[model samples]
Target: MTEEIQSKKNQHPADGQQRVVIVGGGLAGLSAATALLGRGVSVDLIESRRQCGGRAASFEDSEDGSLVDACQHVAMGCCTNFLDLCEQTGLGRFLRRDRTLWFIGPDGSRSACTPATWVPAPLHLVPLLFGMNHFSFLEKAALAWGMVRLAVRQKMSDGDTELTAAQWLHSRQPERVIQLFWQPVIESALGESIDLVGISAVRKVVVDGFLAHPKAADLLVPTEPLGEIFGEKLVAWLRGQGVAVHSGRAVTGIQYDESGKATGVVCGQDLVVADAVVLAVPWRAAKRLVPKLLPPVDESFVGSPITAVHLWFDQKIFDLPHAVLVGRVSQWIFQGEEENSVSSEKSCRAPAKEVEHHCQVVISASRGICDGDRNELLETVVNELQEIFPKARGARLMRSRIVTDPTAVLSVRPGIESVRPHATTPVENLFLAGDWTQTGWPSTMEGAVRSGRQAATQLLKMTDMKAECVVKDLHKNAFIRLLVGQ
Candidate 1:
């Protein structure tokens, strides 16, 4: 049976605890391992990469050697499960919640939209919707009504959901509203062009993200670089929990018995024996390790690209914490928190030089930008920022880099829901976990965490152990419940 793949000899549980081997150290795998804590389970997590965190990751600047995120990852207050994990793991202190979302209009108009916590559910969004100074009064009203319509819209059939969001929005929303309000917002949230994404996905963003509660739209941004937060801090927490974390260890295949039940995973030249396995890697990787357990990775599943342009200026140019630039190539701009340049180890002391102010421009769903020309893309982005912010015109560009993740997020495309697999696989001992899985949410941090917790719970349920890690969504007030008929 172990001829095709290497034999996975069992590493028997030392204390009669259930041995759970998670073959991935991303957020999903990390969360799954966290859930098994104190549940009479022994957990071991293995990540192929030298560091975990997967897409929510960062890289060292080639010139300055400072760490910068590939793309900014933000959490919403609606991401109950992700927030809970952060809080549970002591990573909550690293999160900085920005209540105001700054929107920059085409005419250089700036609007700071902040939802009201004191106000009732749907009404809380009234201030936010009306605060868009770029839109006319009628345009604002139209946008508000369109949101209500989408919120109340019931789930469509699989065939009907295959309609693209742009197709559905063109008929329901106004031209200007679709361009200024819906396009940028939806693209930023979904990480896919509205023309390519499915309608049902947009509905979820509107309902769970905006209408659920006053704080649902609250943005939880990490104060530190994601590399340190997840790759280092998160891994340290897992290690402290008595969970064996093996970074830089890649699992080549999974070993199953005659009944097709997984016994262990073959990592490198070693086999991590386990009573249960959580294949928490991406769909492509999952399919590679256990081909018999998964379907072909075809057009049914795809990824959306996200690009982040890192820029260092001689001085601080933009003052806002973050800005959402509409009607431009830039979707979101964040002020990097790094204040000091990377210190050289040979110097034995830090050298005094002009402190370069760093900022990043994030473009979600940025496919074929400037005809795939990096210089042109950079020039256009700089010009756009200069046009929107007067201060940017005088700032001297120091060093810059364009980072693009071609397959950053799972594309919630037409009819993709039917293809997303459940946590429990056909093999009784194997469970699946990743953002690409069906988590009733888009390809987001919340979805990834929920997927992991779901897989953990499924494993726990099978072992007849306590399995409660998934957190509830933000509370929907009675008014919202009645409006959306939730």
Candidate 2:
């Protein structure tokens, strides 16, 4: 549903000026708008929500009067395009990069995974793998063999896309290794199980994220709520660049000429005309809005769920900023308020005392628990935390909130990559941008930004506006080149 606001008369470009109307105010739409505006093009970005960021947004919680993110979104060093957009939006400084990943066993045994600094690409993780006490020596050897095979293998052929990651990995690695090492990473990254994810998608994650470079696997988390990062800061930056920002306005339908060129979009009763249009909405929304250009709804492109359990304690429970829980319903636990302590900000609406110790537990591909009782989920999460962190055993639970997103991201199912369309469609004037598009990446922020940049580049070319919008991927390090012979 679109949040209605006072209709500002639709602004049309003057003579010789190119105007573009971008539907959807998510990262894709925002990225396209920024790129087009940088090229001296007029942009009118339309969003249905009161704030920008779409699925990666945050809102003020009425229960505890705190601003909580809908779901935790993290980025890796391999995400060059998304990092570039963060730099452009002045959000680079608010990001915190942690190289070491902490893993907590069910019995509360802690293990840290940190790449070897002196070691080169691919081998940089060897030290950590051998040093990790959670897995047996034989398990480590098997896992190493699997990784070697993944790094040395060629790109997925048409036949390979038909196989699931689980099927391929199970054939190569043991079940213990699959459950301990591969399953968590695959589910967290693709928002689906290995049995459901395509082999190509899993290969991309491993090659680009882990084996590409030493720093490629580093995780970057936002210090503030997503609304502050993408909503307030991004909108402010866009306004400073002379682009028209229209929040709380939804584009009901696209306005096309008889010649089959998209002129603009219909926002409520207002007809905002433009020289070009970029439909950056989700797959379902895009199908409903412009079915002529996009194909019919395909169940194959359906999305998966992500659930977050936020808990506030009277005192600090965990010392680490974040930790991955092994053999638990909760996959990752993030210390929300301790890192930067921005909870006192006016936008958060949180009482100073209420946010003393805020923690968030994230469960990706959480279809099993999405419909479960909220109180039961909270209790289960608390029990898991107490088991993992001894400090949490006696901590008083001040407040708790559970946020479940049924369609957090498109499922990376086998054979789904072929169905994903490119930025440039058959229609000349209509462009598409979203994480679901064929960006050669999964449904992450990086993929969304890449799709937007690709859309902007194609739109510029179609309009005869010469400009480069797409950013190149990170170059492979020398070690990878020597090992893989790329």
Candidate 3:
């Protein structure tokens, strides 16, 4: 586990002890605290909201006695950070099923693509040769060729170029291929259009999804609620380690020295002192907090909006755990699995055995769906699902809600790469940690966890260097090339 990895060296200040303060209680913030606390450092985590987990938060619907994951999120097979954290917290065992993505078209056409085995180099082009859904065999083959060519070309040029994903792909391959396959995936991954998204950022998703591991594309949705699997467990673990965590204490201001080093944070009416501080909030919140911390970078880090539609049905409308729906009211639907047990009147009981029971459903990357007009959106999904599943025509709507974050993720457009902050910032005792930062992966749960690990490692290194009078790069020259010239 990263906890022990960062704990080996208990580097402290001249006073022989140090305290670390982490802002935000999301995955990134909690992960940072876990890593820092493991290294024998006292830690304090403050969350501005009443609850933690940020976008990853969940709650029990008092109306149903069933858990509701706000937007119905899942992890992919390539999510190393999620896997590591799961293992660390012993939550890995709860991951129950591997689902093959079913891409359903508006006309009721269906295609199931299971996770492919990972292979390196030329042989990795097998799936494309066979083709899937809209793409022809020839088109798929060409697309595969284009990806390899681009990967090689990127290695050769190695210079950070400013170009949208649409421009880059169109320049290399046919426009139709990108419109059919690339556009849909890109919009879902980065939460924006290809015309505005960056080529490098989109390419990272493709490379990691298609080139990295065999099962990288497979969907891993936990059978239980997200909080049950990780969030609650993580909080318990942190508290067990003697780390102080305060919820609903939003940071109003950051106090810094003349050198621009962060000394502590100002929450509401309290000033909390610390040896080091990590700003692990979302991109939108982070932009508000440290706009001047990194020069020529602040403006680019601001993000685009992402919306999620949560709909509950009277029965199981879509039997599939999760599927990507193209040419529909929504891009994807992640159906929550049956809860292990339900509580009724303060007593635990098995869920009612009936087909006409409440079922959870989440629609991802939905657009043109009015938040106030629930009837309009509900009617639309009902009509759409009826076409796909004739039996769904009888499914009655119980309730529906829309969740949106105007800045869910940073715009992955061109030239934005340079704006992403590193684990260690110019401010000596302050660091940046979030999915938007450079975690190699795209804006994902894995990326967020990785950023947390990076931040913790960095804070520890700074302390070590100060104590020993020697500078050692925990990343150890890995970022030198990117820092100097490519």
lDDT of 2 at 363: 91
Report lDDT (CA) for all predictions: 0.86, 0.82, 0.66
Per-residue lDDT of model 3, residues 358-443, tens digit only: 33434433334534476676677667777777657887766666666666666777766666778887788898888888776667
Candidate number of the best TM-score: 1
Q: Per-residue lDDT for 269-376 in model 1, tens only?
A: 667788899999998898888776765566578888999998888777788989999888898999877443222222224555556778899999998872398999
Top lDDT hit? 1
Q: How does residue 353 of candidate 3 score in lDDT? A: 34
In what order do the candidates fall by TM-score, top score first?
1, 2, 3
Clashes of each: 0, 0, 3
Q: Is 1 or 3 the stronger prediction by lDDT?
A: 1
What's the C-alpha lDDT at position 174 in model 1?
88
Off by over 4 Å in 1: 1-9, 154-161, 338-352
Q: Name the 10 consecutive residues with the lowest summed lDDT in model 1.
A: 339-348
**Candidate 2 lDDT, tens digit per residue, 221-324?**
98888888898898889978987788887789888789988877887787888788999999999988877666545765788999989877877888997887
TM-score of each: 0.95, 0.93, 0.82
lDDT of 3: 0.66
